[model samples]
Target: MTWNFMCLILSLFLSQFVHSLNNNTTDSLDTCLQDFAFRTLIRHRPHTGNLYNAMLPANLSGMSVSIVRLRSRRLWNRGANFCNFHIPSRTIPVPHVKRLALVYHDFGNWSSHYYTVPGYSMITPVIGFKVFDASNMMSRSVKKLSLNTMGKPIVIRFSNSTLSDGMVSKARCAIFSSNGTLHLGEITLANVCFSQDQGHFSIVVPLKRKRGQWKLWAIGIVLGIGGFILIGYVVIASVKVLKAKKIQVMEKQADEDLVLDTIWVGRSKMPSATVTRTQPTLEDGGLP
Candidate 1:
């Protein structure tokens, strides 16, 4: 039990340490990805309505990035749909520009490490997009833009989810807004999410039985088993003590009743003979 308590404390301490370290490290992840996206854009002559795949460095092998150049009028009229995101027809850039580039990315396996929904488990990859002004393609400093959905909501669809597997009833949409705030909402469609603005999006299932809180579950189990072992040891020690006391009491009684042989004659006591008789002593005037 004592050991288990120590282990639980240690786990909590390490959890905090790792969490703090993660926050520090992930703060630069977006900035680094943005630089790479811009490089990809300038490397190629991005044409309107054409989506081009961007390459990632070897260190980030499992991730993906894509960009689509579009005219603001076309976006307001027909909207833009690519890489699982659907911008509605009425949507327009908040600070309107003549042309814009929408950059899409998927964090692949690094999804959970960069973004997390505290009590839920992420089932699919983290995917999102950023809107950027592309008035001058050769320019270095392009301003980030936001969407005005114009009363219509943007939608994100996941191809990896199955609504028939009972996930539809349990899953909720998690939106990580541009300002790094979490917004959760119910999905009207089984495998879809709606949003007025952009950041990151994923579907998460509730941790009803602690499916996502593996650390807590592990600690509880360890403590429970350790307590059981401690109780067993106490019971065994108590039984051993009771038996030892009983044996001691029986030996004491036996010792008290134990007696050596003795002979009594005419109220005069004499030492008892053992295995041989003592020679009779006779009174004599002299040695005879």
Candidate 2:
């Protein structure tokens, strides 16, 4: 009877332990599902259409973006009319996003969802005119131009859902402070040139470049190359001087040895009686 009671207690304890393990496993699975659901919602969700309501998700961080490339409307342009993303007002809208990437495929189409994650701002829309056609090569030619009387550098954020997936080949953005003329950091364009199969991507974050910047870069290169050559010349000249000094020392040593040798031969060949007779005594007592 006592043995039976002990067995019953042991069984109950084992059952409790198994139940606890099952509960833990179920909790872990639930947490994973919740995270997956959040990510999915972000990727598939659309931005609310309003110019004033630009925002980022509460879980994500925000950053500033700049115009790397700008496009303008022109005659025979094949790209779609400027795809406008209305920034909302009052509340900042968080953009639903997964990743930040630029992709290209064989299909001849531009992707509207160029930026991923939070934060989009369009300080100025594309303006101006350039004559171009809508072909593969021409598709790459239309560039964005400045918007509004070159007004105070516009600083604003853009939300996703500004355009459709296939309409936009590439997108660029820029930010400026209230003062129109003063510039901030280098502007960066998310998409530079989009090709059907591939595209030209910038290795560095694109910075705003003025027309004069090219000339400055050219001058810098020339100076750098010239400086490098000058340093090389100095090093070579130093080495040559060192080598000449070494040779001169060696020659001097040789001359001294030869003189010693001649003196020694003279001493050895002198007659034995006359060899030591000329030894000087106390400087020959010249001063005293």
Candidate 3:
């Protein structure tokens, strides 16, 4: 038992390590993508608001990144909308920077490598955006920022998302936030999700039940109930049979315990008891 308990502890630790390792890998990937996005912004400072695609190395081929710069006031009045992300008006960056760069990323075919919602399968590629301070592009230091949506949510739309059989009814919005937390919410529209902050988001459906499994389950339940009822009836019948046999044994014992005279009835012998309560008294009792 001690050995088994120790093994369980070890397994738990390993599972936690694996979970953290995935998050760590995604974190590193995000750092790399941010660097690439910042470099793209620096290379194209002339066009402040145009979405410029960042050229990634062959190692990250399927993934795409883009960046767009906007002033703080413009973001408050006309929120930036590009790369499948919609930031509505009245949104502003936290810590209040004069300008911010919105970096967009489409994880493309590699969406499952860095993130997964357990018991769910991804139906669309993971797409996300991050905000960073771009107020002083000349300076080397850059910091990340957060968005306050003011109760109005940011929309992430999955275009041309095709839900296969058995997934249409179960599909839901999965948001893996940047802060190491996950959230699941209902799918708004056909294939869309809303978030109040920056995060990687996707559409996921619960794992499907195996074919014909429910039939087996139903059969097992029916058999269990039937077996229980059969056992109950057998027990009741056995008890009644035993009671009848006991009553016969008691009658036999009573017949054996008493001595009786036998009389011939019409065609059967009947047990009859005959006894004198008092004998003839002697002269000592004379006349009573």
Please report how far candidate 1 places residue 34 from its true position, in Å.
Answer: 2.4
Better of 2 and 3 by TM-score: 3
Q: What is the C-alpha lDDT of each candidate?
A: 0.78, 0.29, 0.82
Q: Residue 16's C-alpha lDDT in candidate 1?
A: 51
Q: Model 3's lDDT to the true fold?
A: 0.82
lDDT of 2 at 91: 15
TM-score of each: 0.67, 0.24, 0.66
TM-score, structure 2 vs. true: 0.24
Per-residue CA lDDT of model 1 for 1-288, tens digit only, reads 353344345434433554453443443455556656666767786668988887655556678888888999999899999999999998889798999889888988867767889899888788999898988876756788999998888889888765445677788888887677788888678778888887889988887673668888889999999999999999999999999999999999986786657889889986664777666655874433
For model 1 the TM-score comes to 0.67
Cα lDDT tens digits, model 3, 1-288, are: 353344345434433454455565566567667777777777776476788898665556688998898998999999989998999999989999998999999988877766789999898999999999998876656799999989999988888577654554678888888877889898647777888899899899888769999899999999999999999999999999999999999999997899989999999999888966876677898645
Which candidate's TM-score is highest?
1
- Model 1 misplaced regions, further than 4 Å: 1-27, 162-165, 208-288
Using lDDT as the yardstick, the better of models 1 and 3 is: 3
Error of 2 at 199 (Å): 27
Model 2 Cα lDDT, one tens digit per residue, 145-192: 112212222222222324333323333332211122212233233222
Order the candidates by TM-score, highest first — what do you get?
A: 1, 3, 2
- State the displacement of the C-alpha of residue 252, model 3, in Å, after optimal TM-score superposition: 50
- Lowest-lDDT window of 10 residues in candidate 2? 102-111
